[model samples]
Target: MAEVRGRDTWTEELASLIEDSGVRYGGDSPPTSFEVHAPQSESGESLKEQALGFVMAWCEILMELGRGFRDILRQNLINEDSYVVRKFGGPCSKVSKRLRFLNDFLPEDRDPFHAWSVVFFVFILALAAISVDPNREAVAPVVKVRQHPPSASRVLLPDGRYMAYHEQGVLADTARFSLVAPHSFLSSRLAGLPGVKASLLEEYGIRLVTYDLPGFGESDPHPNRNLNSSAMDVLHLVNAVNVTDKFWILCHSSGCIHAWASLRYIPEKIAGAAMLAPMINPYDPHMTKEEMKRTWEKWLPRRKMMYSLARRFPKLLSFFYRKSFLPEQHDEIDKLLSVSPGKKDKLVTEEPEFEEFWQRDVEESVRQGNIRPFIEEAVLQVSNWGFDIKELHVQKKCQTRGILLWLKSMYSQAGCELAGFLGLKHIWQGLDDRVVPPSMMEYIERVLPEAVIHKLPNEGHFSYFYLCDQCHRQIFTTLFGTPQGPVERQEETATAFEEEDKEEVLQVPV
Candidate 1:
């Protein structure tokens, strides 16, 4: 019984193979019971890779066969006269003088047989035609690629002080875009997205534009600016670039909100948008008072206050903030201070020292005018937006649109994170985020009942590049309805993870 059970299991596994292949045998078809086996199951990979590889290998074999056939024909031609002569023109008069026609004689010159030359010439012509041309046709190269240079630029936004932005990943070299950076600890982290966008364009043609937000890069400290002004920075860039049509928008981290804000002010100008690690609201409603205070104390620097109060107490305050308090909170403060005001800003990561950069910009703004009030107002607006801004989650929508909502390690509130995108199909959220708790994601999922969720296991807040590859495909698919390559595998999965090409998107989600 035990042996029979094992045999039955193997036979059952072969059933589908028999059905698909119509099991055959020597000179006859098999009975219904004949068990044909399918190809062995290896790792749990999608069928796409296997199919492409098979086709590629088969084409290679055909190429080889064509080369081999050409070599055989060349040799056969060179030896043809000699072979015929050796076989038939030996000293044997009884064989008849006509044998010379089939032996060592070229068609016209030797005239082995005057009457039969036409037939022999026709036969040779047919053999050469059949051997060379058809084989060459079978192996002719088919695939071709063309290169187009990108006229991309990274722009600086003045509204929020000095935020970094650039345009990239354009299909035609002519298409342009406005890409916004996410909030994070380092300017480089914000710049990372542009780098990824550039790389993605290299493989898949797409064009975009980007810059840092106020207080993030070379810009002045972002004074108080409403969502409209924040979004208008992009429009201002479009004016600078002199583009007048609907352009694609790539928003990361808190930038999503600004992108959304643009929809109201510049709706007709937007082609599509990609929101990665987007925070529905910049203010985290879930945080307790203690948490908010801690976040502020950890992120806001004294030097920033010096810029704010520098006018009334310029010498004294700048000295104190720059020399003492600001230096103390410099590193962590830079991270928090760089946060973007809208949804889907970039992720936080190790940053270079920002004191020199910030101070230079602060001094420049001070020389230009009172950039402090603008900076202060921007902070106040972000701190206290109307309608319980912290509690409200931004959702996504469009009658016909493409959306990619990539959650980061710190993104805990799931349903609220993307509750706005009611009809979005391609939704991917990192599962093993050390920053945002899994419970938060679960709750978010419950709220977004219909959205498909992709759980990224070995990722974190800064793994933007890792997540960006999937987002890249999803974006192209949405805008052009292109098919996805293959599902990304979970990390550390022994089965097939090692084989996947780890071309981290420039904005690998942490």
Candidate 2:
């Protein structure tokens, strides 16, 4: 006679179920229990109860095996579609076919344990075969990820060219006006500095507008654009945006040329102008020996070399630019941010704000794969500027009172007066600048002797960006009154001004 076990005995029997199932599906087998039990009774009731317990434990084992097979099949499918699988023929497809065949053979009947076991065994053999295949290679799945959108907008000009621009500050009737001409290799977005933005709105109630020159940023390439034509484009931009009031022009480095052109072509439209570490026209015959020496030896040797190359072989220079600076590799930007020997250069590199601004400026400048505008601007800088700086003399008999009244109307103030002379020019230069040598100041002084000049002996060419707050204070104070009251905090937004009615007549300065 044999003894019959209770439900508690089934718990001990099910202990090996999980471990043995793992072994069958490619894991190590667990130790077997050595406890011996008395034989079960031969009566039908006892035998049926034993069979039912064994079937319940077998069902649990099948579930574990099913999970393992599902994971393996998923991995196989991913590998089958991978690059390595496409490049080198592999056994991934064969393994998948075997898995499908095994799944198809699985019975949907009352007792599925034996049939599932056969499928599990076949799966193990298939995996082993795949591992031993000579041409097989491990491959991972490919995933697609999206990138963030750009922070700038493009405006299609009347000439079918696109201009990229950024705007900040409040738009109102009394808003002061500023048109920023950024330095070489800098897009208009460079004007999006926190300090500059704060100072413009808080100090003077001004709106700061900056845009990329043709061939830079998203602006289309205007291969034949001269300094004067570029000024016309800016004027076109001003009218397109409905800026009826006279606006101040601010420039840095080589941007002075554009500012100077604006003053010459549209003198009546300008309230005042300021230039920082401004570059003098290199082609000017009156450039002193000292100026030429500093420009060639100290200030812009690399630019001179590149300009020479660009003038002779533009396409070659374009190829070099694309390979070097066009991509988002950050090599050129890193160089700009790295420590430099010059005081101003080092200052700009160390200042985190300027570093961030410069990096974004360079990136946006080449956003559209148009390095041609930069190259063209470079070539133009070293070449004739198509105008004489001496010919830009102030007209003494001009209606200064009428201009003052117009300014008052724009500012919505009764007695707002011009801070300095009607056509005042301010030139701010850093003595320690290596990019645009301080010697260039002598040329400017010689030509515009009456112009107000601020010489910072310890600063560098990038002093404008590093010392933006101080520069803004000096510039705004000279143009308007001193900044007062609490700093106005406003969210900076971008605006795109499109070309309006073609028949709208534009006033041209005679």
Candidate 3:
């Protein structure tokens, strides 16, 4: 009996507290009473029952508070003179009309208990509708790890910059020679074809190394890096890898300038060099009639515009680069997929394998953030290279048995069986290439007269990927004695446009 009396007393006090709270929140309401009855049990009402009675009274207080907040909000919405209501006229008017309808439905003359009961029932229904299942397991957020290709690896330069590189072919061969390839703008080392590993191992036995230039891909950006400084970084990379034997250099498009710089700076270290559709010094006086005509009409004007933009309106150029070149953006991908094929489709837009490769390469190029290095590389290409092209022309004569012939023969008998293949430089260019005009080939020819010229009549800037098998066969045949086997080819289906190669529509940076 004493326990029952105590529970009743607690319940009465809880009801009184709730009634006072409701009147305080609801504003100028008549006196109201909340009678909370404690459940009777034969074992007597436990503490749990008393606690539940208090919780019920507290819920009633909360419902009254919610009603007060809603009424306040409705009053604010109905105020026509208020700035908030005037500014949001349509929304405020709708809210005011709904509130008025609710008020009319529950008039001031209506019983207070009946009106509060309706509000409490509505609140309970809303709570039930939105309630979450307590038994449900919460899904953990997925943590994504950015994955690079198998060929990708990072090295720390002496200057503390992290340099990303791709190494392909055999690394364990006793007579292995390193072939360093520098990628062009908006391209990664994955752009180069190192041939099938089995064939490279059995025939040439070479490890092809390619890296992201400063400001592109994973390499740290050097805002002030010039062509010569980039060459120096490459040399440091070579030394970091601890390659004692003379290495070969292969470059494409704008990368040719760096190759030339390497040949000048580290002449003794370079065995041989090759440039495919190599970008030439535009100011070279030895340009052919056709080259001069293209330069004057097409190339020069385009370069002048780009240079001016990069120099004066860099922010504008940066904005363009982000919108146009970023692979993560669907705009670039959509543009590529929608472009119509013509003679301009020199790249592997029609080929699935090459397109996939090129897409991944572009994606990785800007993954680190900032396209400034790529832009700087472009500007450096059109501007002065800080070294004369004539310096690369000074060839060291090979001595019999005394001095090692770095570039004398394509294959070397002493260090590598493929060392003799080192000195013979090749510069392959396409007449139809719009990215770097065929006229640029004339400038390369003038500077490096000894460089064997392969002029493709039908191909354009990116035709090498389409004719990748042929290129491999040609390269092997030139270096090694004969072609090993039939090269694997990408599917010949027009999947997307080689939008990157469309220099006229989309400006080629270098």
Q: Worst lDDT window (10 residues) for model 1?
A: 143-152
Please give, for residues 1-510, the per-residue lDDT of candidate 2 as tens digits. 122243334434665664333222212223353443334453567779899999999999999999999887668744768666676555756645544543554556624557677767997898589558765322312211222246655676778887777766546344655554544544545544335755456456776777778877656788589988888888877776667878878777777778888888878788878778777666578877777776667634346646566555565567556655654445433232221337666656667676566556666666666667766776677777777776664423322378766665665645543322357788888888777777788777777777888888787766664547776666777767765422232212111122232223344334
Clashes per candidate (backbone, < 3 Å):
77, 0, 10
Off by over 4 Å in 2: 1-148, 153-156, 180-183, 192-194, 311-315, 332-341, 395-422, 484-510
| TM-scores for every predicted model | 0.38, 0.57, 0.55
Q: What is the lDDT of residue 332 in candidate 2?
A: 33
How do the candidates rank by TM-score, highest first? 2, 3, 1
Residue-level error in angstroms, candidate 2, position 399:
20
The lDDT, on a scale of 0 to 1, for candidate 3 is 0.64
lDDT leaderboard ranking:
3, 2, 1
Candidate 1 vs candidate 3: the lDDT winner is 3
Give the total clashing residue pairs for model 2: 0
TM accuracy, model 1: 0.38
RMSD (CA, Å), candidate 3 to true, equals 25.0
TM-score of 2: 0.57
